[model samples]
Target: MGRPRVTVIDIAQAAGVSKSTVSLVLQGSPLVKGTTRAKVVEAMNELGYVYNRGAANLRQTGSKSGIVGVVVNDLTNGFFAELAVGVDIVVQSAGFVQFLSNTGESIDRQREVVASMREHGISGLLVSPARGTDPSDFAPLVEAGIPVVVVVRSLPGGKLSSVVADNPSGVAGAVRHLVSLGHRRIAFLGGFQDTAVFHERLSGYRSAVTAAGFGFDEALVVPSAPSRAGGADAVARALAVEERPTAAVCFNDAVAFGACDGLRSHRLEPGRDFAVVGFDDVIEARTAVPALTTVSVDPQAMGRRAGQLLLKQIAAGGVSSEAVMTSVRLVVRESCGAPRLAAQA
Candidate 1:
């Protein structure tokens, strides 16, 4: 069996000190002598005694713990990572510790982490809900009066406050940019239809297509995993059809990269033989071969804003159900066959 967790009692015994003295040292009370404090510190280090600050705070005053929980769908993605950093910037400065968890888009996993965080006495939670997440999934936390700020994907008709990108406007701008470059048959590629993000982006493409005086061809919309492999698969399927599109807009940067890889496999060159556009201007987008053209939603800014909103609710002791929509801009670059001279906007 694994060793039991080291505790304050163990520290006190190791230092030859009383339990009350150990507690006083832990609390940084000046009344404790320097030599005794050093002895306790030495014992704590040797015993690997980890403090449960959050739990101790709750026990001390029965008030909110100075800890905030951040649960993301995919921490592996650079977008989410940067977003978490933004949250940390605000949370850390506010004297709150962060508890981060990656759900990998599993509803069960998300629920478990969120519940566990609550038990540990987190004052608030910031989450990027998994696909197909029901509004009811956060019911217990909501009932318990924890402020939750949903970022990225939002629960439609949910009573939760949300902070998300302007998905429709971002894609609409991308479609317009492609059209301006003479790509009449631009295809919307990659992303499962199971998400509200998918529908909003698709809605933009459809409106843009009809606005350009072309009938909305449902055939032009291809759905796949919101991943690089899925992007490549979507391209393969789109190419298999009788009518081929000269240009495509992808769900995200990962898919855009995969679409480029798929194009190369078929002896086609991205930015030369076929034009591709991606959403979410992740860090890798600029450095990728042929540089991905994408919608700049500023994930970090969105995250910072979400953190600020959540802290506001925590301070107010109220939930507003206020949804915030951040704006986006299209960054024209090489993947769309645009000149390499176009600097990132």
Candidate 2:
């Protein structure tokens, strides 16, 4: 027994069919007549054959051509995972293979992933850039003639087509909810101050607070990482102030979680001690120790729409600054404390 030689050719010969027919049958192609496919299968079982899927795929697909590249900040985040599902549906429907790259919020890493995708001959790209990334960072894909779409956030100067949530309106809705519950002293946490999306949200927060007959105190607003540490730090810092806000609105759920953790560290419960709210109602929001009151952005819909946009551009030989804005909703949960004491009285 030298190498246990067995091949598709041998199976085809034994089954009394051509090698092409055996290949078709093995690939599950409907092109093969049922009787012929049954005969090929019977011969395969009789010969103890082991099909090499990698080689078979290569032979059938005629090379590694149907690749679509998706670059996200992190895969561990449920938001990105949901987005991936949406991307997959469209890619699969179009008979394309998907390649996912997590950049871990590193601008340099994003560049590397793009370079690798270009080298691999990806047909198109969908990206959610790291914080503070420049539109020029995506220049390589454009120069290489690869169609690309930015999801969730747009690059500075509106250079790329994007599918993003209506941050201002979403924040306004959140603030109005807090106001209705009699929250006058409200604060904001997380989110980079300079980004377009954050700037819009901050404006909405300020506008809402003012319209609700409350002074917009800059002291209550905190800028921190959109991570747990950022949330915790913001809460601690806000609590240190002479006039601590009775409620806090976060950049996203991660920040809100951290804020809740920070509050607990100080022996204060998040919902009962002070109202807390977060954006981007991630999967964990509902399942957290006390469910998170957050703004829900449809990540899956954004992903699918982004894929569709990029594919459309690819098919039409590129497009101009087309914008698609999706809506957001406030999902109230355990956090973001009850109506004010005065209102209760």
Candidate 3:
């Protein structure tokens, strides 16, 4: 076997200090006295230990590499892109560079990206998990003492900190607006059924539909891929129902765009022929022909919040189990056939 790898613990033993002290020295903490820091540095130098840093880099509670990993399941989504920009804005200001990886909703790709990031000595990790990814997928990172903050998705019982939008309230408000506008049958359109986010948003749709003195129609609940194409296909299915719905609350802006495309293919105009409201007010929402009406989840703000929280956890030298739920609002635009009000949202 090759010679054993050197560790911070070995450096601590050589320097006659506790492992915590070695960790503090590695972290460049001001709390470590100059002399102690010097001694630890001398020990590390003498042993030629430069954080060859396997999971061992993570072994030290607060040691950092000045880099963080951000893994998103679907980078193609503009909302996720905006969210990533938000994360970069915060982390860059804090002197940490972000390593971003897109998994394309592939669990294997997610695993590969995470492993690569870990090997690169990422001080912390921020992730929006892919579907079918178990909470346990994060166990190794946690065990290695890496601070992890999940964004846009919650890992129930994952013992990890998370930042997510208030899905139920956002969708409920959007549905209420639709109901108030004299829409008798409003469909909830386009999203995969497996995700917690989908269920949460669907729950809001159901609550609002039933609370507005309307029976919840299961036929109006259509699950799709949560993509533009998925939205288009879902709309076609909705139109095929015996009693077709007049309006829809889409899973996201992408789906909303797709729904509009689908409507056009059927020679139906979105604002004139049917009403559509979507979540995640992406940049395209404002520029679309009829301008999309959507729930403003402010993905960038959520990204910044996630980045800030992870930095806090890193500095605190422990795991943060805090669950931060950000608020949302409905932005009325033409797609929903809502009149331009005094002010949007």
Tell me the deviation in Å of residue 142 in model 2: 1.8
> Cα lDDT of model 1 overall?
0.87
Better of 1 and 3 by lDDT: 3
2 or 3, greater by TM-score: 3
TM-score of each: 0.81, 0.77, 0.82
What is the Cα-based TM-score of model 3? 0.82
Clashing pairs in 3: none
Clashing pairs in 2: 275-337, 276-336
- Higher TM-score: candidate 1 or 2? 1
lDDT value, residue 303 of candidate 2: 78
When summed lDDT is taken over every stretch of 10 residues in candidate 1, the lowest stretch is 336-345
- Output the number of the lDDT-best candidate: 3
- Answer with 2 or 3, whichever has the higher lDDT: 3
lDDT per residue for candidate 2 within 1-345, as digits (tens), equals 133557889998999999999878867899988888889999987985646454455666788557789999767667888888888888888888889999988899998887767656677888888877889777656654668788876786747778888988888888998877777778988877756677878988988888888878899889987788889999999998898888888988888999999999999998888889998887789899778889999777777888888778766765445788888899988797653343566
lDDT tens digits by residue: candidate 1, 43-132? 998985655556777787987678899999888778899899889999998988889999988999987888778757788999998888
